[model samples]
Each structure stands twice: as structure tokens, then as C-alpha cells.
Target: MSFLNYLRVWLACARYSTVRTMMFRFDFIMWSLVELFWMTVNILLVSVIYRHTREIAGWTQYQMLLLVGTSMIMQRLMMGLFWSNLFELGRNIRTGQFDFFLAQPGNPLFMVSTRKLDLDGLLNVLVAVSVVAYSAHQLGLHPGFGDIVTYILLILCGLIIEYGTLLLIVSLTFWIVGSQGIEGSYFTLFEFSRLPKEAFRGASNVIFVWLLPVVLVSNVPSKSIMHGVDARYVLWLLGVTLLWLLIGTTVFRRGLRRYASASS
Candidate 1:
């Protein structure tokens, strides 16, 4: 399909979701309030910590707030856009809907992925951006116009890396195991990505920083805006994001082949 057509379908789905959400006005309000409340709690937590110390993991309270807000924005947007679609892969396979996906007109993965949008996530993303702006002002971080553009691009890159990680984990459903068990463990480790990289030490640092690289998701993006990102770090971040995307695509393709043959 043409790019415009693809966009039309995606937007239609998003529009439907917005309308559906509007039907339950109270639930939507409650959910939005809950997310905002947690965002406040995150800021308060950092404030409480900063009372005793100047910084955690080399970040002042303002910087920490920005990082946490970035994480919340990245995660909330991703989960809103793709989490449900990706996680449903296993159930679809188990229940024999995988074949139906393959028969669809567009890219199977793309078709399945964009079917749902968490309209509520938009509120949280806005809250996150507000926090970032407020914290930057408090810290006297008047980033240049170019710097702001770079930060937004880096945040997008970080979001892609986050999505790739989710795809890589959820694609394991093709291999056949208790999907729930795997997802539980995946989330347990993934949740740590929310914290500043400084919290990690020694082997843990090496593993998560260079290997899994979830630290780059929020921490590096925040740093890029504050300290400015070097070309080498940008290259590394782009490389890792592409690597995960390739790995996820490759694994899913292979798994699909095996599944098709088994079903036949």
C-alpha cells in the first residue's frame, strides 16, 4: 500500500480508539489523574532524595526529574502504541490467528502492531514534556534551538530502541514456552531502565549499559540535551537500535516459518 494509505488506516484506528475512550468519560479522567499522580510522586521522590545529597548518579534533582520524565514519556507512548499488539502475538499464535495475520494485505507485523493506540498515553506524555521543561528552567538549562531539536530526535531514537527491545522479547512467543512467565521476567528487568545509569555498578553496569543498553533509553537522551551528545555515542546508540530491530525481525521470521511448518 502507499504510504498515505498506510497512514490513513493507522489514523483511523487511532481515531476509533479516541472515540471509544471518550465514551467512558469517568474512566478516562480517572486514568489520566492516576498517571499524573504517579508523575508527581516521581518528582517528589527525587526531591526527597536530594534533601540529603546534592545528586544521585551524578545528576542533580532537576536532571533526575528530566530523566524520569523522559522515561515516563518514552514508556507511556510505546506501551500506548504497541504494547498490546506486540504482547498479543503469543496468544494469536496459540489460538491460530497467526495465519490470519499473514493473510492480511500489508506487512503482517505492521498490520498487527498499529491496531491499537492508548489515547490516555498522550496525557502522560504531555505531563512528561512539561516536567522536562520545568526542570530545565529550574536548572538554568536554556538549551539552544538546535539542542532542543537534537534532544527530540534523540528521544525518538530512544523510543525506537525501547520498541525494539519489546519486540525482541515478545517475539520469543514463536518458540513455544509459557509466555506469561517470560513476559514477567522480561518486565522485571526492563523496569530498571527507568533509573539513572549511575545506579548500576560493576558487572551490572557493563551488562546493562553496553549489552542490553536500556540505560541509553532515558539516561543518555537526558544527558544529550544537557551535556550534548558526542558523535561516537550517537553512532553507538543508532547501531544498537538497528541491531535489535534486525534481531527481532530475523527471529520472528524464523519462528513464523517453524510455526507454519508445524501447523501444516
Candidate 2:
């Protein structure tokens, strides 16, 4: 299909999700509040810690806040766009409901992953940006339009890395019985994204920064905001993002060959 046609389908799905969310206004509000509370607690924890210490792994409080906020923005985008759909993929495959996507005209991976939207997750993105802005203000930093654009683009790269990671994890359902526990592990690993890479020791640093893109995703973006984008860091992040995406789509397609449809 053409890119425009794919976009139209996505817009249709987005409209449907918005209408469904409107129907359950209370549920939407409650979920939004729950996410807001969670984000607020994270910011408060930073505040409490900074009360006693001046810096963490070479990052000052405001600098750390910028990092955390960048992590939040990437995570929020993942949750809003792909989390629900991908999280449900295991269950759908188990029950053979994944056949629905298989029958669709679009690519199965795109259809399956883009069918749902969580407004609350997207809403939290704005809140995360506010935190970043406040952190920048506190640090007496003023980024220009080009800098802001660069930061946004880097955040997008981070988002793609996150989506690819989750997709790869969920794709394991094609081989495993249940993926809930495995899916939960993604969040456990993600908790490290907000911490400065300098805070990690030898092994942890190698695993999170060098081996996996978990730390690199948020760190590179936040660092760009603090001190203009480094060409090496940008290259490294782009390389990792491309690698993850390739791995994710390759695994997903290979898994489709193993899938058993309800009709079958």
C-alpha cells in the first residue's frame, strides 16, 4: 500500500480510539490521573534526593531532572502509541484472535501495533515536557530553535528504540506460552533509563550502555539538550536504533510463520 493509504488507516484507528475513550470519560480521567500521579512522584523523589546531595554521577539535580524527563517522554510515547496493542498481542495470539490482523489489508505488524491508542499516555507526554522545561530553566539554559528541534528528533529516535525493544519482547509469544512476565521485565530494565550512565559501574555500564540501548536512548537525547548534540553520540544512537528496528521486524515476520490461526 502507498504511504498515504497507510496513514489514512492509522487516522481511522486513531479516531475510533478517541471516540471509544470519550464514551468512558471517567475511565479516561482516572487513568490520566493515575499516570499524572506516577509522574509527579518521580519528580518529587528527585527533589527529595537533591535536598541532601548536589550531584549524582556528575549530573546535577536539574541535569538529572532533564534526563528523567526525557526518559518519561520516550516512555509516554511508547505507552500511548504501541504499549496496549503490543501488550495484548500475546493474549490475542494465544486465543487465535491475531487472525484479525492477518486478515486485514495492511501489514500485520503495523495493523496489530497501531490499532489502539491510550490517550492518557499521550497526555503525560506534555507533563514530561513541562518537567524538562522547568529543569532547563532551573539550570539557566536556553536552547535555540535548532537545538529544540534536535532534542525532539533525538527523543523520537529513543522512542523507536523503545518500541523495537517491546516489539521484540512481545514477539517471543510466538515461541513461548505466556509473555506477561517477560513483558514485565521490560519495565524493570527500563527503570535504569533515567539514571546517568556515569552512575553505572563496570558491568552494569557495559550491559546497559554498550550492550543494550536502554541507557543510551535517553542519555543521548538529554545530553543534547544540556550540551548540543554530539556527532558521535548521535551516530551511536542512530546505529542502535536501526539495529533494534531491524531485529524487531525480522523477528516479528519470522514469528508470523509460526503462528496458528483460529481457523487453522
Q: Which candidate leads in TM-score?
A: 2
How many steric clashes between backbone atoms does each model show? Answer: 0, 0
Candidate 1: count of backbone clashes, pairs at least 3 residues apart or interchain? 0
Model 2, 16: alpha-carbon shift in Å? 0.5
CA shift of 226, model 1, Å: 0.8
Candidate 2, lDDT over the whole model: 0.90
Error of 2 at 253 (Å): 0.8
- Tell me the spans in candidate 2 whose CA falls farther than 4 Å from its real position: 262-264
Root-mean-square deviation of each candidate, in angstroms?
2.3, 1.2
Q: Taking the tens digit of each residue's C-alpha lDDT, what string does model 1 give over 1-264?
A: 998989998999899888989898888888778877877887788888889999787878888888888887787787678777787876777667778778878877788889878777676888889888988888888799899888888778877877777777777877764576565554566566668888899998988888986887777778888788777777888898788778877887787776752253
Which ten residues in a row are the worst by lDDT in model 2?
Answer: 177-186
Clashing residue pairs found in predicted model 1: none
